[model samples]
Target: MSKPLRVVVWSTGWIGSIAVEAVHRRPDMELVGVWVHSAEKVGHDVGEIVGIGTVGVVATSDADALIALRPDCVVYAASGPERDTAAVPDYVRLLEAGINVVTTTSTRLVYPPTFTAQWRDALETAAKAGGTSLYASGIFPGFGSDQLALVLSTQSSTIQKIEATEVSLNDHYPVADVMMDGMGFGRPLDFAPWLSRPGTIEASWAGPIHLVAEGLGAVVEEVRGSLERALADRDIEVAFGMIPAGTVGAVCTRAVGVVDGREAIVIKHIIRMARDVAPDWLGSECDATYRVDIDGDPDIHCTMTMGEMQGHAAGRGAMVATAMRVLNAVPYVVDAPAGLLSSLDLPLTLPRFALRTAHR
Candidate 1:
């Protein structure tokens, strides 16, 4: 076999930890180094950072030193409030240094065509200069909805509408900023949150919608976004913290792409802290659910429910799966043409390894 691909895992957060584990397990991959932003994790072994036994690799805060090692690829998963401002330059710098990058940092990067010209051009130019490539993927915008929807459409004869729905309970999601400030989860009903901003949903979900449109040989003429919030009747507790009565308990949002004045492609999100919090809004029967409906000649409907995996919770299962999606694409991204790539440009990226272990 060829030499294992040298890889550096950037950051060791919830998602980053999983990426680290993935690199260590894959026989075709080698963990060369690790970069961490938090001062506390700076000197620990990478294995200790991810709860595995010692692998003899130490974590470092010196990004320059890490990059100087010249790993074949970097799995970028650092995330925070400044992610938007920071990740772009990270991508450009790595690509320009002749290192391929696969990340789950920015959702919009899943399909680079929908990004602003300035951002797209910079990355493309960097990739061209260094002869490298960049790919971003995850469950929702990556495979669970956008790519899966398009793949299923091939079985249709006359497609009329395509709807991808994600119905999940965020009680155990464990992101306080996302639930409180970003989503207004515990805020009053009258308080407008990030998801309710005009055109925000449309812009966020446009990547997947346009991908579906492109896959179906059509163009999106317009995009529309809307959202509704539900107030809690009583105090409730979630992974983040306590949500008091009369605060926002659930949210239902949609991004609809119009084709010839019709809602041709739609992406809907139904998130609730508790099922009773928003019985009136759209919902699902399970803790985590993803459904794709295609209104075509045969009217295809595919539903995927996320449950426990290897004795992990549904939310944990989802996070690991998302990281695996990006890790599995590392080889394809390295071999792909030197530029920004999407799931459409690559073949199916399955899990690198599997055991006979069962979840009971």
Candidate 2:
């Protein structure tokens, strides 16, 4: 029988914590190490940090320790709303050291072909040098933008344009920094959110747009981005904190790809702290929905709605779904060719395990 793959869980944030739990539970994977960024998390059992009890694996902040352990794969879940410049070098170091990586961070790394020449060349070179691979995926850019679009395009006879939309309620999400600093939620309307900064949305979302274009046998000439926000009419309280009246309550953003001076591919986000905040914008038929519309000869449209799973909080369910998307890709990525990859390059990653049932 083949041995379990050795894995290191990097970070313990929203997705990272879930990664630790997933790795611990997988029979085909072994939890060998945990690397953390927070000083307070140092020297604690990873199982305890992720609320899975003690698994006897201590979390460390030392990169050298991780290198010494020689893990086969690292689940990179570190979050950086401002695009921490150091993350690229960190991945470069890990790849050069011969460790494969599957991450939910760095959306630009999701589709290597769309990335800048310097960044793409560096990562590809590192992977070739180490004979390992790197894969980046998540709920939106990973599944909604690239995977979903491709799946829906099978019905299109002559595709003219495609738009992928994500409408999610952020009230249940517990990340304060993501809601406040990154999204500008609860801030005054005039304040620019992190995503609204120049070139931020384009850099982060264009990869997926290009991936869709490539899948449809077309090329996106230019990708443009735009953002708009709505102010709250009354104070509202959510999981993280309270939002005062007149603050930003909802945001709608889009990254549109132009082919031949016409919009051919688009990614749209409609995020609201409260369901009532953005009445004019698109609302999900369910609690949260990922909708992909293909405007073409056949005109295909598909939607995915995720609600409470086994009575857990809605936001927590979303987080787990995102983690699963990354986790299920592990085996396929390990066996794939050594290079930076996109969803299009991999086979369908289906979950091998089933949910526990009450029946004995």
Candidate 3:
């Protein structure tokens, strides 16, 4: 049989830890090395750092050392609230070292065409230099944004509008930066979250909106976004931390793709620090869902919800799904032509050999 694709996982944070586990479960992939940002995680067995039993691989903070291994692919699962600013250099270095990258960090990279000349050229230059490729994906900008909308468009004969929404119950998601710093949940009403900044939503989500519009042979002339915050009247519990009374407990964000002065493609996110924070936004029960509503000749509404898997944490299926989506694309990214790639550019990703055995 062909040698297992040599792989390294680049972090052990929220998604990074899970990515390590998913990569470990793959018989077709070898977990060769792990790179870490935290000094505490350095030298720990990757299996142990990720809560999996020891598999004999240690984590290293030295990027050069891990890159020196020349693994076939690196799952760049590190957090990048700043997107290109934080992760681009790391990606460039890995690509220049002939290491392919699959990242969940940057939503902008999910659609390469949305990038400016400099960022696009920078990655392309490094990728071509070492004959490697980089693919960015996750649950939101990754699949729920472009893939779900485009895939559901198949059933439509006449297209009018496409709306993609993600309703996440973050009571179990404990990432502070993501929940508080990036998304602004659990913050005060006057506190400006990253999601509230100008052009933030457009920059982060327009890729998928434009990607969906592109795939459907339509154009989005003007992209627009909106945000609404829900405050907690009383103190509440959350995985990240306590939601202090009278703080922002929920947020509903919308990015619209305007075509011919009408909303054509739209992406919305309803994020709750607790289960009932935003009851009118979507469902009331605590769960994660990616739903696409298409208004066309034959209207269609499709929603994908996640349930616990064998190895992943209970009520954290969506996070696991996010990691697996990028991790499962390792083989495809390795085989793809050298450059930045989007979902539209790659072949269908399958969970190869993932269905066979339960977690050992």
Q: Is candidate 1 or candidate 3 better by lDDT?
A: 1
Q: Which candidate is the best by lDDT?
A: 1
The model with the greatest TM-score is: 1
- Provide C-alpha RMSD values for all models, in order: 2.6, 2.6, 2.5
Which tens-of-lDDT digit does each residue in 290-331 have in candidate 1?
889999899999998776422244476568877888899898
TM accuracy, model 2: 0.92
Worst 10 residues of 1 by lDDT: 351-360
Candidate 2: residue pairs that collide: none
Candidate 3 residue pairs in clash (backbone atoms < 3 Å): none
lDDT of each: 0.85, 0.84, 0.83
Q: For residue 223, what is the lDDT in candidate 2?
A: 84
What are the per-residue Cα lDDT tens digits for candidate 2 across 4-64? Answer: 8899988998899988888887777889999998899999998898888999999999998
* Model 3 ranges off by over 4 Å: 80-83, 175-178, 284-286, 308-315, 358-360
Q: What lDDT, from 0 to 1, does candidate 3 have?
A: 0.83
